[model samples]
Target: MDARFLGITELTEVPSVAVVIDVMRAYTVAAWAFGRGAEKIVLAESLDEVRALKAVHPDWVALKDGPPAEGFDAVNSPGLLRSADLGGRTVVQKTTAGTVGALAVKDASLVLCAGFVVAEATARVLRRRECDAVTFVVTGEDGRAEEDLACAQYIARRAAGEEVDAADHLRRAMESRAASELTEGVREGAHPDDVALCVELDRFPFAMVAAPDDSLMVLRPYAVPR
Candidate 1:
């Protein structure tokens, strides 16, 4: 199996398997949500779609670009999801990169959303499946963010049976602008705890797989050995 790393811009070139990385917060939050027993997470490409979905399914939790709306369970923050009771509930998520990147790879034979939490499981799955080609989509803000790139690299190396230093990757991500926004409280609706949560590599022992449910893509957690 061969693995290739690319940013969200190169989502057109479909591979046998695709993994979308968003270490800053999106996939990190998703891991926490699944850890808390979330049934399924719906990935919405736009905030408008999130709202429309919420209108029909009021019980669904919605997390959009900015701060979460009033009465919503939580924002797109991993720390916030830590305290949420999402058991048996569906979450509607719309992010700048993660969800958008996941939706863009419709042609991929298999699609998975991941972060530091599920890096090992993702790598294990790829090797077990023996995919001919795998694409690691680093879903960053404008183009490629340090945190996402580092996560993608880590997964790629692990999938290729290489030794990865998790601490070094975390150190590099902490120095990134994306990490600084959460640490320095620069980005609106961002919490310092969220940054800390996102950097905890291999925190979860499950990988999120994307499956078609009617007209939407639902991310469902599949447990893997730690």
Candidate 2:
């Protein structure tokens, strides 16, 4: 199982299997939300798309970055999902990098999203797929998204059957500039504990994968086949 890493710009060239990673609270928040019992998550490409989905399915909850906006159920934060009773409900999530990168993948036969919280589980599932080359999409295509690149590389290494030090990966993620902003509470609607939540390596036990559901890509946990 060979693995390759790509920034968001290279989405078009991705192979049959790919994992879109957003460690700085996008896919990390997604892992937490799934662990908190959200039945499904719609990785929407835009805030307007999220609103339209919510209108069509009022029972579905919507989450986004920063302060609360019109038609959103909550901000994208791990701590907030802690007490959220989202069991049997759908969640619509839209973020600048993560969701956009996911929506941009047009060629992958299988698409997954990841962060350190779900990296190991994601690799496990990928190993079983037996794809020729698994691509890790670093959602933060910008040069400074150290955490995203690190998480993507970590997952790629694991998928290729290499031993990795989880603690070291966590350390790199914690030291990123985005981590500083989150911990300092300078990033809007980000709680101090959110950064802590984001760096919790392999916190979720299942991998998050996506499938086409109407116009939305439905993301949910994928367990090892029984």
Candidate 3:
């Protein structure tokens, strides 16, 4: 199926496979960690619980979700991942929107984590699988952001086997006239670092999928690490 973009509230009504984007930090960092050789990423709804998991797996790496204002690691900065030496560790991640979407879409036929950094890879995966119906669940700022829309459209077009005209998508996706306008939203409470990270067309080959349990699900594309 062709991939489409849906707002979080619209997710419950959509029947297509969901590719959730918490790009500002959640999915972006998850993608970065996986790309950097992290074995897996455990997405948690609660920061305290993430820390608890870290306590048990002390050797595993951990990062908390702190937005730009809070001065915490609420969103994993791309620069941080790019500069760190992750090697083969597993990263335990918690975010306001990314993990929350993971928990919310626990029942989707196939729940995949995506971001601009991994958009091309994600599109390739979807096309290879030939999913009958696909949708992008964009976890926006309080559930709103143009970055999510742009990424989703990029994937959606790819899934449809349509040629991607970056310029066209940017013109339509942004609120203002130019691609530069999209970045302006970042200053209005959106994470500027995240905004920058999400705009990176394609930077990773790894994908993050939900590993379902009962109440919550974790975002890790590969097998869960011990």
Candidate 4:
């Protein structure tokens, strides 16, 4: 498959498969939710929608951050999600970067949300797809989120048949201001170990694939071998 690297601004033109990346936490949370055996996750467009979905379907596990509302299950933190009992539950996720990136994608047959924790596995999933082009949507537009860009490039390189290790990319992510915010408690509700958790490259053996289902962008963990 031909690999295309683009920022969120260029999401207007997508092809074949698009991998939306948010390494600071959103996709990392998706990875941990799957690792916790979550049945599926529904992406919400706004915090209001996140609350509405939970209010209507109280059984759904809602996750959001930045504001840390009263009703959500937890903030968008990978450290918290790592130990969450999400098995057999539907996760309603709203985020600043990852969810927005995934929702912006148009005309792509497959959409996969990714982070460093699931980067290599995502690449493997992309490699197995019968498509002419694969686009990596770098969801980190904020000055602090260089990590998202790093992880996106890493996944794209791996998908394009290059032999690469994730260590270099991980280091770059650690140095980003997003990581600093997590460590310094600048990002509200961020877990203490959030940075460390997000940088654990290839921590999951599955990829988070998002698809449209009943008006919700449903995400499920698709198993992929390392």
lDDT of 1: 0.83
**Which digits, one per residue and each the tens of the lDDT, describe model 4 over residues 4-69?**
777777655656788888888898888888888789989889989988999999999989977567
Cα deviation of 45, candidate 2, in Å: 1.6
Candidate 2 colliding pairs, count: 0
The per-residue C-alpha lDDT of model 1 at residue 122 equals 89
Candidate 4's C-alpha runs over 4 A off are: 142-144
lDDT of 2 by residue, 159-220 (tens): 87899887777788889888988888877867768878888888878899887887678898
Worst 10-residue lDDT window, candidate 4: 136-145
Every candidate's lDDT: 0.83, 0.82, 0.65, 0.83
Q: On residues 1-226, what C-alpha lDDT tens digit does candidate 3 reach at each position?
A: 6555666676656354788876565677787777777766777767677767767888767676544433233245664565566677777777667777776777777788887777777777777777878877877754456666777778778767788877654444344222343356432223345445555667666567776655447666643221
Please state the error at residue 29 of candidate 1 in Å: 0.4
What's the lDDT for residue 116 in model 4? 85
lDDT of 3 at 208: 70
Between candidates 2 and 3, the one scoring higher on TM-score is 2
